[model samples]
Target: MPSDARSTDGSDPLDLSGGERFGVWRAARARRRREREEVRRFTAVSRRRRITWIASVGGVLTLAVACIAAAYTPVMAVREIHVEGARLVSSDLIVRDLDGELGTPLPLVDRSAIKAALVKYPLIQSYSVESRPPSTLVVRIVERRPVGVITDGDAFDLVDVAGVVLTSSPRRPDGYPLITFEGGSGSSGFAAAAAVVRSLPTEVLATVDEVTASTVDDVTLTLADSGAVVAWGSSEDSAAKAVALQTLMAAYPPDAVARYDVSSPESVVVDPR
Candidate 1:
């Protein structure tokens, strides 16, 4: 019988022989094995990538933690404090006040504490604090300058331009003129007097012994040794009045003049003895 002939029992006409069927089965099995091997390779590659990513993330987190820890340690602690822009107030006093912040970590230093410590000093008008990395803290201060002295009962109170009492003593300090106002430092008269005193030239200021103001418009200054009185009208045209007074004083010597009226400034009058 032909090898390709149909069976008489109605079996499949093209049915494979045993060897051919075995070969087909082997081919399918090989294909399935190859597919399984490819799946395993892909899974292994994916797992390796995941492990590397996790390791990289863990390394970064560990490095960040170490850096933060170092910042809070003695390695970044404040070792020195520097003070600047202090004139009347001693730098040593400011440094002593900041001693509490010493040895604290640079990143952990409390700025509010520093400010609180500094506020106790009335001389410090304004201040700034700077943190220099790894070891140093810097403090810069602006001090209030005393412009005049006020007589408080028997004691003399040194005051700044804003009328803040800087210091008080039983005896009056030299170089600062005595200032008196009708309503005290908070009055408009004192405000006007303070402004006039601040505007005077150094030469004129040196000769002033006392300043008095009853109202904002009526301000007067008395010369130190000469006792010459200056009638300065209001705070207006103060600079011009200062110049006029200087010229008038130069023209008529201090001993020769009793009074100077520079209220108008443009037209100055001098009363001579």
Candidate 2:
């Protein structure tokens, strides 16, 4: 051993040789390289996160601008109007009534205003509105059905089951019976008469000439050719009463029986004149 490498206390001491110095230098260099690699990884992750956030923000802004442009532009405005399911009311009238909604945007049409205009026609029972994109608006309506005719001096007023007068004509229309109520069409008596008339079978309905009701429970019907009368007490058990009347007519024939009382359908009464 060289004098310069001697132990201070004659014990085995650390030797600062050239080989040991090289090993220390290698350990320090490895530590610095690992720290640099960690920093590079962190920087890469942070840069990727910033890029993702920017892309998400840009996409949201583009969608918002496109929607605003579509809503305010005239490309989506109503240019045509179509009316459907209107029978008694003319399609021309519905289109004319909706004229104010023509230039408005399809998404901004006022449904309440459309309903207000249609309410002026008493025949429209129900209605719906639909928008056809790019330029069209469609309105569908269900009209009231007339069941009977009421005598109105010089003309006859056609009425539905709810007693709404649809139209008046100079003479009676075919397939409808004359309805006479002690009170006017608005009375409960007329409602009962309407129910009885509406419940009659097609064969029996065609045979009815006149219907009269003083009260809701005193409805009566007169046959056309045979002139046989039917006493329908009330609107209750109407289906049963119709069946019983049909059976009685079939068994006795219209000429043999003067009247049928099916008000209490369980105990039907027949009067032969």
List per-prediction Cα lDDT, in the order shown: 0.92, 0.90
Stretch of 10 with least lDDT, candidate 2: 1-10
Q: Once model 1 is optimally superposed onto the true structure by TM-score, how far is the C-alpha of residue 264 displaced, in angstroms? A: 1.3
* TM-scores for all predictions: 0.74, 0.71
Candidate 2: give its CA RMSD in angstroms: 6.5
The TM-score leader among the candidates is 1
Model 1 lDDT tens row, 1-273: 557455778778568899999999999999999999999999999999999999999999999999899889998999999999988888998899889988999888999999998998888899998888878999999999888999999999999999998888999999999999988788898899999999899999999999999888999999999899999989999999999999999899888999999999988899998
Query: Model 2 over residues 1-273: C-alpha lDDT tens digits?
Result: 546665678655665689998999999999999999999999999999999999999999999999778865798889999999987799998899999998899989999999999999989999999989888999989999888999888899999999888888898888899999987888888888999988999888888999999888889999988899999999999999999999998898888889999999999999997
Candidate 2 collision pairs = 217-233
- Each candidate: how many clashes? 0, 1
Native-referenced Cα lDDT, model 1 = 0.92
